[model samples]
Target chain A: MATLEIRDLHVSVDAENGPREILKGVDLTVKQGETHAIMGPNGSGKSTLAYSLAGHPKYTVTGGSVLLDGEDVLEMSVDERAKAGVFLAMQYPVEVPGVSVSNFLRTAATAVRGEAPKLRLWVKEVKEAMAALQMDPAFAERNVNEGFSGGEKKRHEILQLELLKPKIAILDETDSGLDVDALRIVSEGINRVRSTGEVGTLLVTHYTRILRYIQPDYVHVFAGGRIVESGGAELADKLENEGYEAYVKGGASE
Target chain B: MAEQNTTGSTTAGSIEVGTAGAGAQLAGPGTGRTTVHQPIDARVAVKPSFDVNDFPVPTGREEDWRFTPLHRLGGLHDGTAAAGERGEDKVGFTLPDGVTAETVGRDDARLGKAGTPVDRVAAQAFSGFEQALVVTVPKDAVLTEPVRIDVRGEGGVRFAHVVIDVKPFAEAVVVLNHEGTGTRAANVELLVGDGAKLTFVSVQDWDRDAVHAAQHSALVGRDASYKSVVVTFGGDLVRLHPRVSYAGPGGEAELFGLYFADAGQHLEHRLVIDHDTPHCRSNVAYKGALQGQDAHAVWVGDVLIRAAAVGTDTYELNRNLVLTDGARVDSIPNLEIETGEIVGAGHASATGRFDDEQLFYLQARGIPADEARRLVVRGFFAELLQQIGVAEVQDQLMEKIDAELEAAV
Candidate 1:
């Protein structure tokens, strides 16, 4: 039902020296219900694409056309983009002191859903989602990410993904700091949402270990600030065996 | 009164410059010491006195007065403004059973027992008031209701003094609510008796054109507990100095304050906790938020631990949240410890602007900019607000904070 198209997207970030381009003429299209795994090495602009689509002020879209269902996504404000159903699971979610998780979730849901959810049903919904994520009941009363462990932070991001239920959810390195058990738990949460078949996922990672669990429908090799190769899920297995060193060297020569 | 006068003069003693660890040992020099020397540190250099002449008018240069704007004080510091007669409704009190409230002459023996005037304004307030209101809770009595004193100021120069005395083994809560328009200077003395427990709250909700300065001095008695909460929301210029000293061993004090400043308003809080006795503890935490141009806030916390005060546990923390471009915050926390034998002593101060990343995180979840700002600001003050035990006061303060946020937007 929803489609995201990124055409020749050029993004720049203010580096210490000057404005440096990160995503150089990158293009991609993802439709609802599709799982696209963007595989890359460090500093290969995989995360840049995710943040740009979410409208982070840090990355300036120099030349790009990001359209969501024929609407210009690039012209929308960050919150507007979110209200239009785009979510970014940040690699490092900032700590918000004094804001309890329950309060934050309710506020966010009220903003996104355009009406405050019914109290009884909303509480029950949050309780059930947290239980599925194996989060403690007391976690709802805690300040957001105040003193959470790395695994706990990742789980919290997935909890938001499930609750917010955005049309396009970009998971930015969700498996980077997760342990084996945590990885399995988080992947299970993602697959549960994917089973709804109403959300498109852009799973950006530097490893193929997570692909083993989620089974991406499309795998894109990102190098030199753009996608250099695209294929089916078999490409993820090839990268698992051969590694990104091949594309890193080949993209540099281009 | 004679003993107080002698101590006041001897403690006013001499100023010692460039002396090592002089500030930590200068709390009470009249306890049998002949050659008393003042600490070079301006915070504790000036001794307390009941006479206004002993302290000179602050020209906004002294460390204690530097953060304060003297021009906006409406002549409370220099004794230039004429005192207008206060109406009968100026000061009113609501006392529960077993509690007494009366107006006593300044010559009463109980007037200056808790503390002497620390600065020129406090001394002026001490020497200027015609009568002092004294509220006392009887010995061994526990009150179910709070004692409320409402001081409503009419537009004029005014001087006021109040004393809250809790008898031995008594437990009570006191709320001092200040409102209306006035250029006023006040001194409040809190005396917690042996084995007594007291919680005192002072709310400064004045009019927009008011200028007010007050010193709150608390004496924690033997084995007693004292808690003071100062909330400042309205007023063009407001400065509060809350000081605590232990009267005996095993005393405990907790001082908490919250303030929000709007455009062209100056709110300052200065705190001093003197650990002059052994086995006493103190904690100070103050938080403030500023919005709009020229909205300034100052918080200075000074904790002195003398050598005689062994087994002392003290810590002071201050945090400021600047919510706009031109708002400013000055937070200074100073701890001077003369003994290494104490339990623990530390201080911390931090002033930070509204975080953009926090806003982004909230907005990414679909919260609008203004609502996100409100949430973050509310959360910033939530912890300190909960410490205020009175629910009605807390709700009112939250509403005021929301109004401040809305006005800023």
Candidate 2:
């Protein structure tokens, strides 16, 4: 079992005028086998928290302590954090030209597993995983994300998540730009990993439609760069009806 | 040529210049629609000659020589490097069945039939070499294996000439491999007969202290096809020019090049595709990677479509990847068109550093930084390596590329 803890996490980004703080005194905790949905409006710094844990160079941790099973997550390099079982499914995955999907998956699997997988078994594993997601077998031969459609990019990110099998998986707006069919396919993929009961999921999004597919153990209403309220799955239904207007007004006043 | 003029008079007379990135197409009325005239630009009007005196010695100021380091040419630009005798081991050839190789004197009737010398070094090489190696394929024959020619230098000054002739309806592949150290100037001529197909590969794997300058010219007959792959990896200073011209309509040509420049290495490639016949097609793609301080690579692509050459199609692309600081790349693409009745014409050039986002994307998957860099660099050159068409050479080139990347660290 693994757990990720973020305490008083304050993050800032360099702006035209000066350094601007985005995440202000945010605190969260996610344990294995649990799904946490962080819902927020535009510019609420929800994605900031996702990228901060991934060690993105754009975001700086001003004052915070991120611990993954008592290890200093904040001090780890991006790849080191990944080797420690942390994965980030970016909102907009980058295009890597000339790198075929099959080669990329194999290389990533080798790095994470600390040993090369048997070619015969690995090929079967990839084919089965691709078929489960309704992906065409020919996609394995294409360059990663090169000229891929929006839905296809999202599917590729989920594919990586399924293969890497990280301890802490952060899905940043994975449901955005996905059609109904694609959303179901990607959600099913995540559920397959979740069913393993060895992974913690942090799903960040602006809409509650994804909640219809994957239920969360806890729901956090994010506003003004921090989680304003936290509750069970019932809080999501409240936000869907009451909206974030009350919290936004309160955050601005403070 | 007169028949083409008669046909050109009936078409719309206009000139168009299409800039790749700007998406700007400038069209204007052409002068003397029926009469095909060369552009007044001096750079495109240099007449081909066989005499050294007809071309002046380069002074590092000419448009063709400006990017080249004249001092590092080891006197190939002038008459200072005298021709030296090479041992029997200096040049070797492995020919397949139905292919013939022989050394002939300058009086041979087929010498210089493909092209005449366009520069002083080439002209000097033409007038200096006592013997030329000629490889010929019979008519209507297709060889299953490729013809290999290995040229090894033992540290001397030499001038050389080579000719490859493919008869009508014949098909063949040729590989010219260069290695070892020397100061050399040479000329290569390729002749493709009507309905014939030829694929020629020239590799410059010279020693680190070697200096080489060469010009390759190909003449494609009616309905013939020609493909050339130029690979340059090992050299202190190497400059090569590959030019193509069609003999009749329905001819096609493809030129592909790959180069890797290490520290203190200078590699340059200049190409020209002359479309003087109707309905001929040509394509050019060249890619290079530069690493370490003082590593430089230059690529210049020039394509000209005359007024009488109706229904011409051409496109050229050049891309460079800079692996480290202190490396320089100069890429230029020039397209001149005189007929508006063509299918298409375009060119593109881009030079960029290793993308940080790509590196991050790989690293985020647990790949180390150095391994990520290698993956990206290998991916950058993967497409061109496949075009080489030789499995053994491709594997060797990959190993060389990996070694280059290892040294960069």
Question: Interface RMSD of candidate 2?
Answer: 0.9
Q: Which of the CAPRI classes, incorrect, acceptable, medium or high, describes model 2?
A: medium
**Interface DockQ per candidate:** 0.79, 0.72
What is candidate 2's CA lDDT for residue A31?
A: 96
| Candidate 2 residue-wise lDDT, B1-409, digit = tens | 1111112121122223432111111121121223221222236334566778777888888878899998898877777775344422288888999899989988777777676677788888887788988999999999887899999987878788899999999998888999998887889989899999999989898999998889898989999999998989988999998989887899999999989998999999988787878999998989899988999998988787776679998877788999899999888777777667888887777788888889888989988888888888888887677766768767877787777778763
lDDT of 2 by residue, A104-178 (tens): 899989998898889999999999889988899999988889899988898899888988899999999999999
Cα error of candidate 2 at position B373, Å: 0.6
DockQ of 1: 0.79
Model 2 complex DockQ against the native: 0.72
- Model 1 chain A scores worst on lDDT over the 10 consecutive residues at A245-254
Misplaced by over 4 Å in model 2 are A250-254, B1-45, B83-89, B387-393
Candidate 1 wrong stretches, greater than 4 Å: A250-254, B1-45, B82-89, B389-393
